[model samples]
Target chain A: MRSNTRKYRLMILLCIAVTFFVFILSISIGRYSIPFWTVLQTLTLQESVDTTIRSVIFEIRLPRIIAAMLVGAALSVSGAAFQGLFKNPLVSSYHLGVSSGAGFGAALAILLAAGTFAIQLYAFTFGALAVAASFGLSRLVKGSSTLTLVLAGMVVSSFFSALISILEYVSNPLETLPLIVFWLMGSFNAIRIPDLINITPIILVGIAGVMLIRWRINILSMGEDEAQALGIDLKRIIGILVFCCTLSTAASVCIAGVIGWVGLVIPHIGRMFVGPDFKKLIPMSAIIGANYLLLMDDIARTLTTGEIPIGILTSLVGTPFFAVLLWRNKVGWS
Target chain B: MTFETRGLSFGYAKDRTIFENIGFSVGKGEIFCILGPNGTGKTSLLRCLSGISMPLTGSVTIDGKDLHSLSRAEVAKRLGFMPQLHSSIFPYTALEVAVMGRSPHLGIAASPSERDYDLAWKNLELLGISSLAEKPYTRISGGERQMVLLSMLLTQQPDIMLLDEPTSHLDFGNQVRLLELLRRFSKKGFSVVFTTHFPSHAFQLSCTVALMNKGTFESVGPAETQLTEENLRRIYGVDLCVEYVSKANSRTCVPIIKNDDGRGVGAR
Candidate 1:
């Protein structure tokens, strides 16, 4: 047990270091390709560095990097928490209809030619609305079982998905249609420093909430009766857990459009590295998720002259990598 | 602690009551067993006693405090319950499951500390399953999982324990081992109430045994008196032979073998 604890701690430290390394690496590898030393110098020297390099590092790359890290960490932590709460390893924020709702909201905003802030606001609102609809629908059923909630979420997701499609169909084909579609595909290309600053606290607060009640989250996964027997107030703790997961997932979707696969797979990877104890799993997932998305975003910027949509790249990379993780026996549902 | 229920009535729907007007009391250092047929509301009665559900027509009190009025954590601190064992979706280790027993003692945001871990480990030792600590609970045998659950209950340090069908899934040896453990807990001044489908188990534990039927306990008394062949037959609707074994110096209950058409061979 002592040795296992040490190994997990060491792995977590290594993951954090790697996240830092990847953050710096991602910032240096844009179209202009600043060297590592110059990137460091530009960050530290403030006003004294060369103007163009400083702008590229500070104005463009820095905000994007922060956005990628925050969105990744937020989605991954929410996914891990949701998986534990639902007691289903396959559960992710996407399945809760939040992402689909945000997608439609973003599509509608794009069709209306709303500004960036309005787009984010609409996305967050609709994402929240979608979960509310799902919850409400579940309650209307005779018995609001977890299975009922999941089914209701699917109904909401399909509804929002249809709404997004209708928005695309009605828009002017030349101008708004492609823009809406691209945004639906997801990217951090439009991320500004102010956007990053605005969403950071929400994501951090959400993450902290999950971390604070993480042990109870584990108990909740033990099933309703067992958790109740252990004196966990089922309604209160479950409410807090659902709120945190939805908050983080909505915030992530609002900022990054609708990046996929990170929330679903990163937690599984974390479970593989350490065991399923949420105390270690949540933090490990955050570190790994930050590194994974930072690297993917780096590829998004550097792969071709045009920026690859982050959503596409994640599925493209995530599928094969998930396969490899399974091949390597890292699927630690246990 | 004294556990008492007065005229308790409960059911899922208004018209269909599972059990009604039930009354019983148990004091410290007493082992009480409830025995009945499979669908006889045995588990439901235990659920009410454990405060998982409220009784409709009556009240359960723990040391004169209304059980329903106490906070969930407070109830858990005084009364630990073990439901029928189940496999969790996530494969948590036995140690992880055992440590969760400390939840009642913890704050909302608190995880188990080193002291809590020590307590959990101590209970696992008491159950004699300390070596299964690191094994994934899903990978362990059902009997081991049962022991692990008992360890978790022990870690709660409750004054009274309400266990539902505790021996349903255990092997023969594990069933005996678990009954011995329950006897030990009763001797240590912990009041225990468990529901069972086994009459022999009631006799083996030497506790207060209650025979439940359609709605309430048909008979409740010392195990030696309450576990008679007639009462067992009345509750189970099957003829039983409850006999004493002089060599083993204990009683065993078994169904009497019947020929075709549910009759004893000698009758034919």
Candidate 2:
């Protein structure tokens, strides 16, 4: 696979093409769909547009699309980071319990915050801080390895989740249980223009920061001992990466209510498409992830009268894809 | 560039001591092999000298500058290190893996320059591994990967090279080839330091030897002086022999493993 550089190049090209196609379809899809031409015209800033249609397309769809795109990219990049840091191909933020930490933060915001935008900020803040604290703790302890980090993450996540569950159990079910349930299932419906604005800075920083230090990340995948011999500051680089991934995870959770598998599935997809170089995989993972989630959200929204939780849909769709990957490995093609 | 660990001591943590009061120096153009058995802190000494771990006491100075004074990147720019072996899961290409050595020259957002690519390409070509430039590093044989790693170390263009058993996982031919490469590199004035169980490699190419028995250097001298039969026996704690043998009537000295009986096992 590494020999056939052309294969990765082609896979990347095809993914880009497919993602753009899906992005166009995602823009056109929703509760009162616009025509493809109208969508295109609006994008180009043409005149004589219907105000209601314009609001629906620009205000509702555009923000949702961006949120989907950012979350998708965030998950994949973070997933890749965790995998590289741990030096295990199977590691992800969710499995490391970063998701539960984030869920706790979001729940805390939901339970305590009074305003919508403030809650999103609070969730992102607490979420990123929680995982950062776990990493910090792991660093202080003696003889801490990746397994130790994972164990610490799980413990931290469990403690927070238990607190969240206690909060849920004590609250009025009629008022709060459905809110917690819907939040757990995950969604893109709650995001507004203001919410997107709140999430934009951190996502922007993470996306750009990851791309900037992308090669360092690739070197880091070699494991810290070798990387350190090669002159990398192992702890510092790992810290920055953990921060970026935490921020990315937090922002995504703030908007999407814990969308699963975008991080898990997209990186492998990007790797399959682009080999292991983060220079290529990072961006492709973001784009493909964004488009995948957006397309899935469109399907979830239109497939039934009742909205499907995005977390559920991702698990349903991604598990089979993950199996296909395992099967492909068995067949020796991938 | 010379490497020296003067009265150096190190531990994994505050209480765990691996080595103590170690002192040795490598010349600017020499292969100084650290010869010792396991649990003698061979790897720990290398780690301390390479600046990967701080010496609990004493100083490691490379090229007249103290190791602690130099930044990690600064030290890395002049020194290249290779551990035993690493097999990557991503299956990077030989060129790609080699190109990673250019990291010291890069900043946050910079791409590989033309010079960087040239260094990578030239190193691969120099190792006679130009054909593997496009091959997956994982797909290659263990010996080939070792060659690729040599190419990677060469790509760094360092004046000082530190290796922990560079030929441990390699085959006999690969061992010779790698030792030859290191010899050639030393001839170009790159100081090379390595630890190994094989003394013939040092006897063939290296100029000096640092023999350790406990937690410190017990003997340090010219290769012929420090790697003698008696010294090697004492260091390795085994009966051994190093003698010239004729292959097709040509004379060559080979280190032959001897049993306790201390007799040549076959025709020599």
Candidate 3:
């Protein structure tokens, strides 16, 4: 038992190291490439680095890199929590329709020619609203089982998705349509320091909340009657988890557009590394998710002169990897 | 501790009441066995006793405190419930699953400490299944899973243990072993309440038995008195004979099967 604890601790340390390595590597490889040493030097506040390199590091690459890490960790941890809370491996961070609602919000802001901040605010508010609607709809049922909540989420997701379709249908095809389409496809090309400043606390709080209550998730996954018998305040714990997940997920979508697959795939990978105990799985998912999105973002900017939207890359990369995991029959939950 | 319920009733809807106006109490160092046919609200009664589901029209009390007023943690500290069937989504190790019983004793944010794990391991060792500590609970046999769950209840250290059809899925030997464990625990001052389909189980323990037919218990008394051939026949609609077995030195109930023509099969 002691050795097993040691092994898990060592594995988590290794994952954190890998995440740091990826973070540094991502900062170094952009359009005007900076050397690894210069990137480190600039990060350490050394005066010997060139001003252009420092500006590029701090102004462009650093904010986007931080944004990538936050969004990735937020979505993945929320996904892991939701998967455990719902007791279904197929559930992702968007199980409550946050992404669809945020997509519609961003599309509406674009239709109104709103600025980036207004778009983000609208997206966050509507994303939270969508989950609230789902929860309220589920409460209208008799028992309000987990299945009912999931079905309600599906209903709300499709409703917002239809609203998005309507907005796309009526907009100017040449101007607003393309803008909305690109935003919906997802990108970090426009992430700036102020955007990071705006959403960082909410994201961090969400992640910290999940981290604090991760062990309870294992109890919660043991089914409703069992958990209640074990003395868990089912309503309170589930409410806290949903609130935290929604905060992080809504903040993630507001910033990064509808980035998919990271939440669904990264937790499975984490499980393969450390197994399904959420105490290990949650932090492991966060580290791996940050590394994954940073690498994907790096690929997005440097793959061609014209940047690829990261949502496209994530789906393109995540689908095959998920399929391989499934084909190998190692999706973790037995 | 004394676990008591008064005028308890439950149903999913207004018109479909499963059970009504039921009342019982089990004290320390006693075993209370509830015997009923299938779909007779046995599981529902256990759920109400464990505070997993509230009784529709009455109160369950633990040592004179109304169950509805106490917190869930407080109820769990006094009552440990082993469900009839557990299907875990994740493949947690047996030790991990057993350690979850410590949740009632720990704070909401706290995971099990080394001391808690030691208690769980001690219970597993007590049950003679310590080897299953690292094995995935989903991979173990049903009997072993029951032992693991029993070990979890032991680790919970509750005064009253409520189990719903605990022996329903077990083989013969496992069933005997589990009943033996419950008997031993009762002797050690734990109150045990379990529902089962087998009347022979009640005879084996020589415990207080409640024969439930439709919604309420038809009879509640000593197993020897309540589990008569006539009551068994009326409840189950099958002729059964309750007699003493000189070989096993205990009483047993044997159902008398008849042929299509109404004569007993293999009759002399």
- i-RMSD per candidate, Å: 2.0, 4.2, 1.5
Candidate 2 structure, TM-score to reference:
0.92
B150-240 per-residue lDDT for model 3 (tens digits): 8888888999999988997888887898899999999999999999888899999999999987889887999999999888889999887
Displacement of residue B247 (Cα, Å) in model 1 is: 4.3
Of the pair 1 and 2, which is ahead by TM-score?
Answer: 1
Off by over 4 Å in 2: A1-17, A94-98, A143-147, A330-334, B13-16, B244-263
| Highest TM-score scorer | 3
Candidate 3 DockQ, CA atoms: 0.69
**C-alpha-based local distance difference test score of model 1:** 0.86
Q: Note the clash tally of each candidate.
A: 0, 0, 0
Fnat of the models, one by one?
A: 0.68, 0.34, 0.69
lDDT at A278, model 1: 89
All candidates in order of DockQ, best leading: 3, 1, 2
Q: Could you say which candidate leads in DockQ?
A: 3
Candidate 1's displacement at residue A325, Å, is 4.6
Backbone clash pairs for candidate 1 read none
Error of 2 at A165 (Å): 1.6
DockQ metric for all predictions:
0.61, 0.38, 0.69
Candidate 3 overall Cα lDDT vs. reference?
Answer: 0.91
